[model samples]
Target: MADSPEDTIAAIATPPGFGGVGVVRISGPNTAALARAILGRLPAPRHATYAPFLGEQGETLDDGIALFFPGPRSYTGEDTLELQGHGGPVVLDLLLSRCLALGCRAARPGEFTERAFLNGRLDLAQAEAVADLIEAGSAQAARSARRALEGALSHEVNALLDALTGLRVSVEAALDFPDEDVDILREAQVQARLADLSGRIDRLIRGAAQGALLREGLRLVIAGRPNAGKSSLLNRLVRREAAIVTHIPGTTRDVLRETVSLDGLPLHLVDTAGLRESDDPVEQEGIRRAWAEIEAADAVLLVVDDALGEGEEEAAIRARLPGHLPVICVHNKIDLTGRVPGKQGGVLYLSAQDGQGVDSLREHLKAQAGFSGGEGLFLARRRHLDALTRTAGHVATARDALAVGAGPELVAEDLRLAQETLGEITGRFSSDDLLGRIFSTFCIGK
Candidate 1:
């Protein structure tokens, strides 16, 4: 992701397919010269003008619009040019080759946006949202990513930074006058302010957590005995026949996985082989993989056949659950049992064949994952969440110090660490390794 100080980068911006038009994006100090060589003349800054892109041997590569954006006010904060031409891959390649022949290097993935970050046009969180919005699987995910792209998350972080800075000022002031008669640490106003800041930090942490869930979604694994309606329930939820359903036990001896969005949160639902001891080597290996999935899954869904009653099969299923996992026990085949489908003690009774009580099951899954949101939440990445968690831990340590009547020196040290941790979120305090990782995830034409 490193860029030379003087190298100009170019790339075909449109997706690789036939289309009405494609874009050749270029950025660097030499963009104007490349534009002039390809278009025969430089178009007005930030204006589109029709031009014929010429190639070697004076052949017309393509005719399209030429747009130029001078440096420091463009997407990458550098002189940039956009050449729009026919969507044919060959035509786009000819235009790109023409630009390269005139001294422009092909852009690496995420090089465009990385330059934007380095130029101070956007922060780390906002830059990531650009990628998230492009790859969002649902309308809700796209909307949330747009909010982060608009700086919603950065604004909140900045607000927290300001609060932390003010508190540091007060704490240091108190430390300066150690012998004063008035107890600065014990003052009612000071305690009230500190409590308010802590509460706000908690609220921000909760919001970021929800945003992270929306971005990455939750992983759910369905495990149960044979003939327990696991495949039936999966097919019913996806509203299609993605898995083969049979009355025979042990029909599904391999893992079947699907991605579905339920109520705005993406769900990676996996249907595993029935958890039973089998002499068949394939089935035994499948059962082992099922337990591995259960260990890493955010939630485990246990399916039970209600008509069959809780016999040895059901007992085996219950015994397989890992310690401290959120389990959604499902009692399938409720329609045949003549009982209404509902939840009782974290278990839901339903009929997967008839699609009965699936709505309630989806809601339960979301609630268990803490996804009580659709809009108004900013998209967040794992790195951003880690920073928030680290900063919050420091705040918690400072609160504990306050409770024990610790000296201002200890409290100030904790606050300083918290401030630096938060600063890393916005690149105010970050290592080059972190920057490289963040920008490497983006595409070349971003």
Candidate 2:
């Protein structure tokens, strides 16, 4: 949709369902007029007043609390109104219809937050955090999203940008005045400043990577021969019978996915069919799909029967795993082997049937994700990580350029590019298409 602050927008702010209360939101220059037409009078700014919501013929459609927020101080940085009434779908629709009849257009998804970003009330990162907070799956994810909404990530990015700007100014100044007796770059310690900036960016990259992990979680695939306790491991990790546990080979002929929270980190576990050559078309197809899942997974859990031990078949499975993907070899059924449940030779030894050594596997997954709980973490998206990574690359290039006695012009350009790249996270250098793609994912009435 077009960015039109002049046009009034209204929507059912609450989710589409029956609840104790639902909110119909309105914002624009016409908010005052709409309030007068619907509420009979504009309620005091930021104050909730109980009133009857009027219809076209001045009929009382519903009675609820009306709240008015004048321009520049509201969520959208414009005149905003909210109607809190009974949450029946019909009632909410009636209230929304009244607003529409009085000159308010229906709000598109994320229009409210989009307006907030455009009106300078929140940066892009904070606007995205608003949605992240709503979609957070765990307490730690919620806390991280809250921190980001409160400008934790933005503060760090802005500080880095400011420092980079200052360094760029020094480098450019040296370029402008070549005949000066004083080497401005040397005097200002440009090299040291660049080095320091690079170090800070590196740290930020690491933190953002962790935050990204918290946001996106990990897609782990459990792959092995049939009846190797892969399904048992899946059910054990999720603490439920998510997959069928049968002694028959190839009992699991398809991929089954379940999500579990490991101390706040979301683990998307996929139990795939056993990987073994079979003449049956259905079994062959399952094996093909299993390999497909393995190719797309972030990590693989290669479960093997400890009683059977690692044979040539297990070695072949390990050999087929993607080299870049992290693979955790799980030696299950330790109970059958009369061995203690623990980790040995970096391979997890566990009995999935009786829940032995599962806790260790949980810790291993968390550690592999680099997630240390919510403590001081900020929620981040893949785009944020990508921007930071590109910024780091540019900064490193500039540092190398400076070290190699490169001209001030070349160093200044690289620093400028680095600053611009960093600005993408905060919308300073973002494109319209980027904003559209980012905000479109948010639910309506946000």
Tell me each candidate's TM-score: 0.87, 0.89
Query: Candidate 1: which stretches are off by over 4 Å?
Result: 177-179, 182-190, 240-255, 274-294, 314-321, 403-405
lDDT of 1 by residue, 35-97 (tens): 878887899998989998987666788999988999899999999999999998999988888
Task: Score each candidate by Cα lDDT.
Answer: 0.82, 0.85
Per-model RMSD to reference: 5.3, 5.2
Per-residue lDDT over 3-115 for candidate 2, one digit per residue giving the tens place of the 0 to 100 score? 47689999999989899999999999999999999988889999989999998998999999999999899999999999999999999999998888887899988999999
- After aligning candidate 2 to the native by TM-score, how far in Å is the CA of 243 from where it should be? 15
